[model samples]
Target: MSTPANTITENPPPISTGVTPQRLSTLRRWNIGLTILHLGQAAAMLILANNFAIPVLSAYTAGRPGTIGLTTSNLFDLRIGWAIALFLGLAGLDHFLTASFGRRIYERDLTHGINRFRWLEYSISATIMVIVISMYWGIVTINALIAIAGANVAMILFGWLQEKMNPPGRTITTMLPFWFGALVGLTPWIAMAVNISLLKDENLPASLYIILIVQGVFFFCFGLNQWLQYRQVGPWRNYAFGEKTYLVLSLAAKSLLAWQIFAVSLFS
Candidate 1:
C-alpha cells in the first residue's frame, strides 16, 4: 500500500552513513574544508598576536594588595589572539587527524553517539576560552579562576558522557546527561554575570554590553544545536546536520569573539 504524498513520519530511520564509500568521501571533503578554514584562521590570529597582548592576572599573594606580598610575575602578558589561535589550531588538528587516519570512526555519525576527539578538543580549547573570558570580565581571583576552569572542564566531560552513555543506535537518548552538561556549562557564565554586577559600579562600556549580548546568543545557539538534535527537530533530526551546525557555530563563535576582543582590547 502506498502512503499519502503529504504524510511524514515523526521518527525517520537513522541516517547513519553505514560506512558507504560515497558518504565517506563526503565526510572527507567536509573534514578537509574544515581543516583549511580552521588552520587559516589560526595563522591569521597568530599574526595579530604578534602585536597585541592582554594583561592577565598570573599570581597574586593573599596577604596584601600593594607592597607586602610583592611579586615580579604577577600578570600573564600575552595576546589573547594567540589563545584564540590555539583554539582554532586545535580544531584544525582534530579535523586533519580524523580525515587522515580516523576514516573508520568518522562513519559512526552519531550511531556510536560519542565523538571523543571533539570532547577532547573542547576540554582544552573551550576551557581556555572560558578562562580567558572570565579574566576579561575581572573575575580574576585565584579561587574564582580555578572554579571557572573546573566548571568548563566538567561541562565538557558531561558532554562526553551524554554521548557515551546514550549511543543512539543502542538506546533512546536519556537526555539527562545533556541537561546536566548544560547546568555545568551555565556555572561559569553565572559566575561571570555575578562578578560583573558586583564589580562594575560605574557605567560600563557600550562595547562590553555588545560583547556580552553576542556571546550569550552564540552560546545559546551552540546548546540549541544539541537540543534540536535530541528533540529531532527538522534538519537537526539528522545527526550529520547537527555536526555541521557545530562546525559552523564553532567558527562563527570563535571568530566573533576573537575579532571583537582584538578590536576592543588589543588593537593598539
Candidate 2:
C-alpha cells in the first residue's frame, strides 16, 4: 500500500536575499557623507575650543587668582580635532567593512558565518571599551563614568533583546559601530568640560559655556539625524518607540541639556 502524502514532511531551504552592489554603493556614499560632516564639525569645535574660547577666557581673566588656561596645550596637550577625525574615520571604515561582509554572507546563505561575525563584533567593541576606559581612567570622573556605563549597559541590553526577539539586519550591523564611535568621539570633549567644572575656577563658567554651545549643537544635529534614520531602518521601529517619539525625545534631550549647560554657564 502507498503511504499517505500527508505523512510526508519537508522543510524549505533558507532564502538568499542578499543586498545588491548598488545598495552597498549607496550605503557607502551615505557613510562617507556622514564622515565628512563629523570631521567638519570636529574641526570647527577644535577652532572654537583652542583658538577662540581659550584666548577669550585667558584674556578676560588674565591675572585673576583662580583663573586657569583653557587651551588644548593646558588641558590635554593633544590636538582635539585630529583625534576626533581619526576616530570618526575608523568608525566609518568599520561600518563599511561590517556591512560589506554581512551582505556577502547573506548572499552566500552563510548563517553560521553571520553568527560568528556577530560574536566578533561584540568582542571587538568590548575590548575597545576597556581600552578607552583604561586610557582615560584618571581623566574621567566618577559621574561621567557612571553616565557612560549606564548608557552602554542600556544599549547592550537593548541590542541583546533585539537580537533574540527579531534578529538583526545588515543595516544594523553597519550602524552599530558608527553609533558607538560617535559616542566615544564625544568623550574627550565631555572629559575636558568635567575637568574644568571640577576645578572650580573663574574660567570654569566660560569653559562650561563653550562646551555647552559646542556639545549642544553637535548632539542636536547628530541625534536628530540618527533618530530619523532609526525611524527609517530600525528593526523595532514599528513596535517600540515610534518615529515621532524617537525624534521628539532626542530633540527634547538636546534642548534640555542645552538649557542646563546655559544655566551652569550663567550661575556656576
Among these predicted structures, which one has the highest TM-score? 1
Query: Residues 1-268, candidate 1, lDDT per residue (tens digit)?
Result: 9989999868754444243456457767888898998899889877765456555555556565564663334456646777888888988898887788875675554445457777888788778777777777777656677788898888788877876765555556678988888898899899888888787457656777677778778877877888887777877766666776777887787778777777776665
**TM-score for each of the candidates:** 0.81, 0.36
The Cα local distance difference test for each model comes to 0.74, 0.39
List ranges where model 1 is wrong by over 4 Å: 1-23, 50-52, 55-75, 109-111, 201-204
lDDT of 2 by residue, 115-223 (tens): 2332333333432332232222234333444455455444434333333333324334334543564565455446645655566456333544544455446444544
Off by over 4 Å in 2: 1-25, 35-82, 98-102, 105-157, 167-199, 205-207, 210-268
State the displacement of the C-alpha of residue 12, model 2, in Å, after optimal TM-score superposition. 7.6
State how far residue 16 of model 1 sits from its true place (Å). 3.7
lDDT of 2 at 42: 38
lDDT of 1: 0.74
Top candidate (lDDT): 1
